[model samples]
Target: MALLKGWRYGVFISGIVGLIGLAIYPVVIDPMLHTDKYKEVQKHNRAGVNQEAIQPGNMKVWSDPFGRK
Candidate 1:
């Protein structure tokens, strides 16, 4: 029972640490690493453009010639 309790405690502590790291990352690491990318995204947003919008050339139209409807 002690071993099981220890394992559970370890898992709980590790989960808490992981959560803290995730919370810190966006506040600290993301701005430090991707500031330029964020700025470009903001610029596009201000210009009424969605960065995720697909371009025309990338569209795929599937035509099934061999499959029966």
Candidate 2:
């Protein structure tokens, strides 16, 4: 009975560790490791919008919904 209980505890702790690893991997590890692909996707995702079209004025955010660029 004691040995069985110890294996259960070990399995539970290992599962918790695996969950924490999965959470950190995407946000931190993947970006640094695959920077070029990341940048390409980021640009593609922001296709229609101009981030700072007019720096000191009202045309800050512009978007054309129908166009990819």
- Candidate 1 residue lDDT tens string, 7-67: 7889988999999999999999997777777767766765865434644666654332233
lDDT of 2 by residue, 1-69 (tens): 445367788898899999999999999889777877776787799888657854557644544433355
Clash count of each predicted structure: 0, 0
CA RMSD of all predictions: 13.1, 8.3
Residue 68, model 2, lDDT: 52
Clashing pairs in 1: none
Report the poorest 10 consecutive residues by lDDT, candidate 1.
59-68
- TM-score per candidate: 0.45, 0.52
Clashing pairs in 2: none
Model 2: lDDT of residue 25: 99
Residue ranges of candidate 2 with Cα displaced over 4 Å:
1-4, 45-53, 56-69
